[model samples]
Every structure is written in structure tokens, then in C-alpha cells.
Target: MYSSLTEIFKILGIVSIGSFSIVGLCAFLFKKLFDYYLKEELARTQSNLQLKNEKLKIEIESTKQNKILAFKTLHEERALLIKDLYSKLYLLKVEYEKIKLQETSLSFEQLNSIEKECIEIQKVVGLNRLYLTKSISENLNELIKKFERTNEILKDLFSIGENTFSSMSEVSNYKPDQEEIEILHEKLISLISDIIELLDKLEESFKLLLNIE
Candidate 1:
């Protein structure tokens, strides 16, 4: 009976060790599986983040291009309006000079007729000048407001052109010296020239923004 009990205890000891070993192996396998699943999840999350970042970058670039195109179009339209204003002013100046010359040369009856013509011309010219001036001022004001908004967008979207137009408009409004007025036709001409150049620069900037050759 003593030998049989010893044998039974030995068998039990081996069985217990084997059972513990099997449980330990199972636990290790489960831990490895969990670690593998966590790694896969991390990689997927990183990939999604990268894709989102790329999409944001694309949207930012598209917005910048749109702003540049809009500015270029506005600049072009403003320049054309300025040119028209200058041309009208030039015509008025020419008409005034002719009337002045006629006044100096004519006789009583002829001068009277000439005077009537001059008065009629003055009336028409005055009306036209008033209309042109008002239109130009309104258009300029509108352009300035748009330019201010465009400037803000440019700064936020990308580092781009400075707001030179607003400064130019201010300078154009400054009262001119008599000598300056005589030397130059008028302030309108100078303003138009500046606008033309600015429009050219704007066009180039738009081309670059769009990556168009």
C-alpha cells in the first residue's frame, strides 16, 4: 500500500506540472494575438490621419488659386474704367481750349454766336464731367472695398501681393499743384497708368497661382 501511494503521488506531480505548462503557453499566445491586433489598429489610424492631412493641403491650395484669379479680374476691370475716365477728361480739356481760343479771335456778332455755342458746350461738358466723376468715384470706392477683403484673404490663404492699390487711391486723391496739373494732363492719367501696371502684375500672379503657362 505504501508503494502504491508513492506511485500515485508521483503521477499527480507530473500531471500538475504538465497542466501548468499548457496554461502558461496558452496565456502567452493570447498576449501575442492582442499585441498584433493593437499594432494593426495603430497603423490604420495613422494612415487615416495622413489622408486627412493631404486633403486639407489640397483645399488650401485651391482657395489660394481662386483668390488670385478673382483679384486679377477685379484689377483688370478697374484699370479699364480708369482708362475711360482719363479719356473723357482729355476730351473735356481739348474742348475747353478750343472755346478759349475762339473767344479771343471773334467779332461782336460772331463772338455772340460763338459764345452761345460755348455755353451749350459748357452745359453738355459739365453734365458729362459730373456723371463721369460720380461714376469713377463710386467704382473706385467699390474696388477699394473689395481689395481690402481680398487682402485679408490673401494674408490668411498665403503670402502674396501687398495692398498697393489702396495706397495709390489715397495718393490720387491728394490735391494737385497747378504746375503738376499743367505738366501732366490730370491725376486721372497717372492713376490709369498705375492701374495698368498693377493689372499686369495681377495677371502674372494669377498665372503662377494656377500654374498655367
Candidate 2:
């Protein structure tokens, strides 16, 4: 009977040990799986964050490049406009010199041509005035006014019919009073000097703007 009791006790102890081993094994496996899955999730989240950062950097770079390109294009366009204005002024200056030196009677066609040139210069300056400095624009306006004044002086000296042109094709062959011509010629000389001075100023301004030495 004692042996039977001892045998039953031994069986119960073995069963208890087996149950504890199984529980420990299950707990170890659960902890290992949990750790592995946590690590994978953290690694995936970090990777996603890195990719997002890279994408953001690319977007920022693209925006910067776009701004630079836009500015460069605008600068080039402004430079072209300035060059165009300079050419127009140069042509006007040549015309002024020719008119000043000419001894023949002034034709209506010549006056009309000069008026058209002035109009064209005004149009160019007015249209792109925003690209120029305020001082430059004001000087240009003053230059136009001087050009118109010179034209009016010429018309007054030459025109016979009410001192105004009635036809662009008409030629004014009537000689202006010699004394009046001399007086007005002095005025013309002064105006031409002013025009040359203004031209010099504008050239310097343009040079500064274009970074020319």
C-alpha cells in the first residue's frame, strides 16, 4: 500500500513539472514573437519617414530651381527691352543732327517722319517703363518732351500756312527770316546739347544696370 502511495505521488510530481515546462516554453515563444514583430514595425516606420524626408527635399529643390529660372528669364527680357530703347534713342539722335545741319527748306514729309519716330520711342518707353528705374523713366519722358519741342520749333521756323502743316506731302520752300533763324538756331544748339547730355546720362545708367565696365 505504501509503495502504491509513493508511485502515485511520483506520477503527480512528474505531471506538475511537465505542465510548468510547457507554460514556460509558451511564454518564451510569445515574448520572442512580440519582440521580432515590434522590431519589424519600428524599422518599417523609420524607412517610411526617411522616404518622406527625401520626397520633401526634392520638392524644395524643385521650387528653388523654378524661382531661379523665372528670375533669369525676366532679367533677359528686361535687358532686351533696354537694348531696344537704346537703339531707338540713337536713331533719334542721328535724325536730330541731320535736321540741325540741313540748309534746305524743311519738307512736311520730314516733319511727319520725325513725329512718327518720336511716337515710336514714346511707345517703347511707355510700354516697358516698369522695367526701368523711376529716374530713367522720368528722364526718358523729359527727352520726349524736348524732342517734341524741337519739332515744334522747326515747324514754326519753316511752315508758311498758318505756321502749321496741312499736308504731309507739302514742301515748305519759303525762307524763314534770317534774323529769326539765327536766334532759333542758338536755341537749337542749346537743345541739341541738352539732348546729348541726356543721352550720355542714359547710357551710363544702362551700363550700370547691365553690369558693364
Candidate 3:
């Protein structure tokens, strides 16, 4: 009976050691699997962050390019406006000088020719004024309206001159007074000066719009 008991005790000790080893192996495997899963999750999160960062950089670049394009467009438009304004002013000056010259040489045919040229100049100036007023910024609308009103007054004055020239062409006895001609010339000069001042202001406004000031 003593011998049997010893053998059973030895068997039980071996079984306990085997169970402990199995449990330890299972715990080690579980730890390794948990660590591997955590590493995969961290890697995915890092990749997502990198993609978002790259997307933001691309968006920033696109916005910068759009801003540059917009500024370039504005600059080009301002240049065109300046060119048109200068041309109109020059043409108006030439027309005024022609009218002044007509006073010295009093020929009906010459007056008619000068009147035709003046009409053409007025047409061009009118078109330019329309464009200028249309293209002006909202901030300058009041100033633009003032200039437009002045342009309308000039247009009326030119129309009166045209009618007077027509009447003079038809009637040979009609002669304009020297003093009246001189006064009209002075008024024309004053109007031209006002237009030039407005154009200078418009240029300054454009510069401000471009943030160049």
C-alpha cells in the first residue's frame, strides 16, 4: 500500500507541472497577439494623419495660386482702364483745339468738317465714359457718378456747338462774337482740366485697389 501511494503522488505532481506550463504558453501567445494588434492600429492612425496633412498642404497651394490669378486679372483691367481714359482725354483735347482754330478762319465748310470731327470724338468719349463707369468699383461709384454727370453736361455743350455749326453752314450772314467764342473756349478748357483731375483720382483709386499704396 505504501509503494502504491508513492507512485500516485508522483503522477499527480507531474500533471500539475504540465497544466502550469500550458497556461504560461497560452498567456505568452495572447500577449504577443495583443502587441501586434496595437502596433497595426497605431500605424493606421499615423497613415491617416499623414494623408490629411498632405491634403491640407495641397489646398493651401491651390488657394495661393487662385489669389495670384485674381490679382493679375485686376492689374490687367486697371491698365486697360488707364489706356482708354488717356485716349479719350487726348481726343477731346484735339477736338477742342480744332474748334478754337475754326474761330480764326471763318469758313462754313471748314466749320462743318470740324463739327463732324467733334461729333466723332464725342461718340468715342461717350463710349469710354460708359465703360469707365461700368467697370468702377463700388467704393468709387459716387465719384464715378459725378464724372458721368459732368460728361453728360459736356455732351450737351457739344450738341449745342454742333447745332450752331449747322445753322452757320446754312446761313451765310451768321457770325459768332469774338468774346463769346473766347468764353466757350475757356469753358472747354476748364472741363478738360476737370476730366484730367478725375482721371488722376481714378488712377489713385486703382492703385489702392491693387494694394500698391
* TM-scores for candidates 1 onward, in order: 0.48, 0.71, 0.61
Report how far off residue 100 is in candidate 3 (Å). 5.4
Error in Å for residue 154 of model 3: 8.5
lDDT by residue for model 3 over 40-90, one digit each (tens)? 999999999999999999999999999999978866776676556556555
Q: Best to worst by lDDT, what's the order? A: 2, 3, 1
- Per residue, candidate 2 scores C-alpha lDDT tens digits across 11-51 of 99999999999999999999999999999999999999999
C-alpha lDDT score of every prediction, in listed order:
0.50, 0.78, 0.60
Could you tell me how far off, in angstroms, the CA of residue 10 lies in candidate 2 after the best superposition?
A: 7.6
lDDT of 1 by residue, 138-163 (tens): 44444344334433432222222255
Q: How much is the lDDT of residue 203 in candidate 3?
A: 73
Q: What's the residue-level lDDT of 174 in candidate 3?
A: 49
Better of 1 and 3 by lDDT: 3
TM-score, cand. 2 vs. native: 0.71
Clashing pairs in 3: none
Leading candidate by lDDT: 2
